[model samples]
Target: MPARERNHPLRLLTGALASSRPWTFLRSSQIGHRIRHSLSAKLAVAITLAALVLLLVFGIIVASQLRSSMFETRKDAILADASLRFSSAQSVFSSSTATSPDQVQESARGALASLKASAAGAGATNVALLRSEGSTASLRINQIEDEQMRGLITPQMREAVAQGGAQWQSVGIRASDSDKVSPGILVGTQVQLPRAGTHELYILYSLAADQRQVDVVLRVLVLSALPIIVTLPIGVFALLHRLLLPVRLTVSAATKAAEGDLDVRVEVHGADEMAALGRAFNAMTSSLQDTISRYDELAKLQQRFVSDVSHELRTPLTTIRMAEDIVWDNREDLPAHARRSAELLHDQTERMEQMLADLLEISRYDAASALLDAEERDLRPIVTRVVEACAELAQRQGVPVEVVAPARAAAEIDERRIERVIRNLVVNAIEHADGTRVTITVATSATDVACRVRDRGVGMTQEVADHVFDRFYRADTARARTTGGTGLGLAIATEDVAIHGGRLQAYGEPGKGASFLMTLPKHAGDEIASWPLALWEDE
Candidate 1:
């Protein structure tokens, strides 16, 4: 087989998979499809994102303000305490009587001890005093012991103190170079003593207590914000789903009614608009059912009348045909013009007889009263008999009847009905051949048989082929109705083939030719699985 013909479905599948559109990804992935299209998922995502952003913004603002306020309060109290102790000790240094460096150091130590005693429970951890003598700096007082901690003084703070104001810096608490650390602040000031000259006074304030208080505030903020953010979307989804339940039910009921179950109805609840819609649907279906019932009754009555009238006319028509035959036989002894009239009268009467027979046959089909009588037989003899019967008509039309079959083809069939079906097709093909040759071909399969009739003139169009099986329909309605074709030969032939569980099909093209195919099961109980011959002779 060619690649295009063998892999057509695979090519189509590959094309679908190679799409780059967003919907392709969403619809192809099971979880992504749900997440992309589900209203609940969209709602949850939107709510969670908005809530988190707001909470984070508020949390940052509060944390920043609370930390700033806490540090400012600690700085104020630390500077106040340092200022008061330095002012009190300034008097002791100013009243000193010694003028030597050793005496100045001893006086400074005495003043520092006095300040430390006066500042008990004031939250200051330690104090340092450094004096500048000429170009060298001397530590006159030192309460903290780490060498690195003694160097914590910055030049900016010293400059601020020298300009006659106090200065402070946030500092970490470290007692030794390798010791544990804690939080604190440093406040320093410049003080002038009588013998020691200008000196720097520093105070360290511990901030561990303030840090613990801020931690408690943060914990409370988290506890208050998390629950509202998480449960809000779930609550909204549950409420919306409950509100849409009735809409889903109404859609389901409408789907069933559209699929041909007119009895389906929706349940009404309360005096809402949905209830009114359900009531209106029920009323429409009830009215429609009543109208359909009336149509069915009228159709059955029409079929009954046709059957009765056909039967009633059969006896009277037989009597008239007998009387006409007697006159037709004596027409040779009459005048020329009278004999010609007799011939036309006889032909018209025969055409009426054929029409009545076709009407009775169609009535039996509409009433579904026809049955098949099957027996095992050879088709060669039956074919020979039909061909011999149609020889006169074929000769009159100047169209040769050609047959192609094996010497012996056997099958189980209703002989009389099958012969009638084949005879109708042969006669129809002869009438349309227009002096061209007609061919009848019979072929046998393991479980089925097929007969084909082909004419080389007056082919059919698509519109005519589609509705050719309708009763009383003619392909060429504008043609003169001169021939005795009652327009019912092929109609009865189709119903007769249907009675024996066979198919009758017609195929044609406008200017080429036409073909009629009849396929049947070989045995009475065997199903027709496939045809033995091709649909078109070109194959």
Candidate 2:
């Protein structure tokens, strides 16, 4: 055989083995991993495997049943023919005339020979006969020869004779002097004759021709089934893949959209589940894009509004501050009530100007239109300066201010912004300290620098703490009066810290005061890699 033909069966078996190995391990590993990571791939693989398994099982069961039925029918026909021949031979011999034993044997031989000749012409082989009483046997034709005829009296034949009944059996016979053995059917019957006593009549029929017919049938079955079995899966897989192709595309587009590619879309095809999915995904993306566009437009409009308001108020604020300074210089010449009112007006005007400035800063941050000129600087000095600026106010409010610095810590930030953030935090702390001392602690680590402003005043509740950084949000309406805050202080400070790629967090509990910690990156243009401040620390 050629190499290709020789390896054909091995190749088929190997392919089957290879296909099964993945299935064995897939259920526990690959399938689970695919399901967790890729839903569409998982579904496609699952459907294809299920269809193939069903086809394979159904094909095997059908082929096995067909083969079994064909083999059974062939065996039954062979037995039926042997039974008819035995019955006919028995009738013919029972009605024969009186004769010598030799003549009787010769007539019987002749009759069997005629039947053998007819069967041989019809493509049968190894026809023979065996006597029951003695070792006498006869071949139906000389074509059978001596070696092929001698082995007719087998154990199965002897048992059939001993049992004294018509019997049928399949046996192997040596057809020639060669080593090859052929399979045959044997029929045995008991015969009784006058003065001849009893003898066994046997007929041997070779199954070579029948086996050749069976082989042809098997070849046909395989030829027809092989194409169907192989092509059916291919056809089904192709149809399924085509049907699901749109769904796969839609899924891919959705993934891209999730990854911030809003322009991705699937081409709409026939009305199917896949097409419906594509349409739905397209609709969702369109809505999301529209919403985002509108948000951008509104943000621009808000930035313009904040800019206009800040510019318009700055001129009036400058004039008011200058006018207040002039009045304050001559406050002793006025009456008691006028002096008090003038001081109040000056304080209120300054507070209003600060409020407007914080609002503009917060609005700019929200619009993402603010730029920072960042540089590496020490955080320890900034904390100390903020503390010094708040010191006089702290004393007037009867609140002691303390500073703690473990080491000189550096961070990459906009110096002006960082200083403003610290100043706002310190002033807010002093205003809310309620006669209790406030502590400013600066700390450092290899990757980050941190400053924490902690106060021992009446603290905020959880609900209030959650929204403490929200613009214009107040923990207590009554408390805001004493604090004299514009409510944009924390919000502005948070935005400034964020612009420097830093984080600001607040920790507080009712009646236990509050702590505000700012953490920033230690290296310029690098992300914050460590948090220096612990959540829980001893005072």
Candidate 3:
């Protein structure tokens, strides 16, 4: 599908919102150390938006106060101006000395006329009077002709007027002649007539002008706040961009260093703490590079010395071996002490020769000159031969060595290298076996071939098992060298097996003995992700 056809912003956004988008953020949080959002990005956005929200709220509050102030001011002015007019009306009705009911009715009519002449307009509204004390308890108003509106003076308004003070209320008022509704206020006061007792005079005013004035002020405030609200985020974006430059550069430098570019350094731009941090990071990388270089140089020198010494000693070692053999042959012709010395010389010479061979092999591996001549071969005969070769050593060490193999276990490998690995495993086990039984098990799986050498001797601890293949690393160092152990046999075997693209592993428990397992791929180029056999057997 075309990209345009595949993605619609609205479509994608709607689908995500309706389903998993919100939860995706939470899912990122659940994977600790892996956050979907950058901290600075999250903080910058949140703070900028928060500032906008606060500004909006402040504008709203200001608009509300302005509205309230306008309404109260208009209310006070209207009430005060209208109160003066109502005062005359109240005096005309309440202070009249008329005793006859007809005269009282006439006085009420005159007072109503005086109120209309004084205060009532489009800005202000109806003025009504309630007859609270007469045989005829009807309501009357000056401007409004509708009797329904004349009766609009509620019981609550009458009660308020009875309290002897003017009070106001906001209410909905509909003109009896028109269906138009308006917001209005009713100010009610108590007045007493000589013939009519406890009458209420209420002046109603519409709040349309007050409402208009408040709306104008609110619109102005909203308009004024808009520029500031918009400009704040841009300012935040600019500030964050400027402040985070060094952090971004530091991250980039760290990334390069992690990828093994030790020379990568962040540019220092300021004398601030961030610049100091960059300098410290550069110093750390420089120290690491120097340390690695020193170790590498030491390793090269060590391998070169081992290679040169082993090569130069081979000729003298061969001559010494020949001399020791001649001495062994003439041992019976010498004194008993001389005969024993010849035997010891032969044994030490043989041991030194084996050590030289192991050292030469180790140097070859370090120099990257060792290569595998892998070919498909059966492993059963190899295991059998190795067990046979180590049989004399096993017997001398008072250990019984056993071999378990199938008819054939075929794999593509360097047969000699595998044979040497088997021999090393067998010999190493015999040395550490301590008169216990040693077992060599050769097994084949569909994908690989494995050989395991096990001994029920003084078993090594787990810590020893981890570094047992390191050069000259012996779990029982004191006895190992005395027992003709070169210490590099396992290390050399490990390196040889790795060249065949196989794995050699050691597993042990303290006092339970150790097992060395070597596994090889059936085909040379095939790699192993998991072992074909368990690293350790079940107790």
lDDT (CA) for every model shown? 0.72, 0.70, 0.73
Model 3 over residues 470-516: C-alpha lDDT tens digits?
Answer: 98887764564335667798898999889888899998877778899
The true-versus-predicted C-alpha distance at residue 264 of model 2, in Å, is: 6.7
In terms of TM-score, which candidate is strongest? 3
Candidate 1, residue 288: lDDT: 73
After superposing candidate 3, which stretches have Cα over 4 Å from the reference?
Answer: 1-40, 60-68, 71-75, 78-82, 85-89, 92-162, 169-187, 191-196, 199-220, 281-284, 393-409, 430-446, 454-458, 476-482
Deviation (Å) of 509 in candidate 1: 1.0
Give per-model TM-scores. 0.57, 0.64, 0.74
Where does candidate 1 stray beyond 4 Å?
1-261, 270-273, 276-280, 378-380, 407-411, 480-483, 524-527
Give lDDT: candidate 3, residue 185.
66
lDDT tens digits, residue span 1-539, model 1? 00001111111111111221221223458766775766566666677677777877777688777777776676667667877877777777778785766777777777776776667567676677765334133424333223544766667655655655666776666656567455676676667766446777776667666766776676667667757766766776676556655665767877887787778777778778767877887787777777877888898998889888989988988998898898899999989999998898899888888788888878888888877788887676777788899999899889999998874557778888789888888887888888888888888877788888888878898788777877778888776433567677788888877766778889888667788998887776566798887656752
Order by TM-score, highest first: 3, 2, 1
Question: Worst lDDT window (10 residues) for model 3?
Answer: 1-10
How many steric overlaps are in each model, in order?
Answer: 0, 1, 1
In the predicted model 3, the residue pairs found to clash are 459-513
Candidate 3: give its CA RMSD in angstroms: 11.0
Best by lDDT: 3
lDDT, candidate 2, at 305: 88
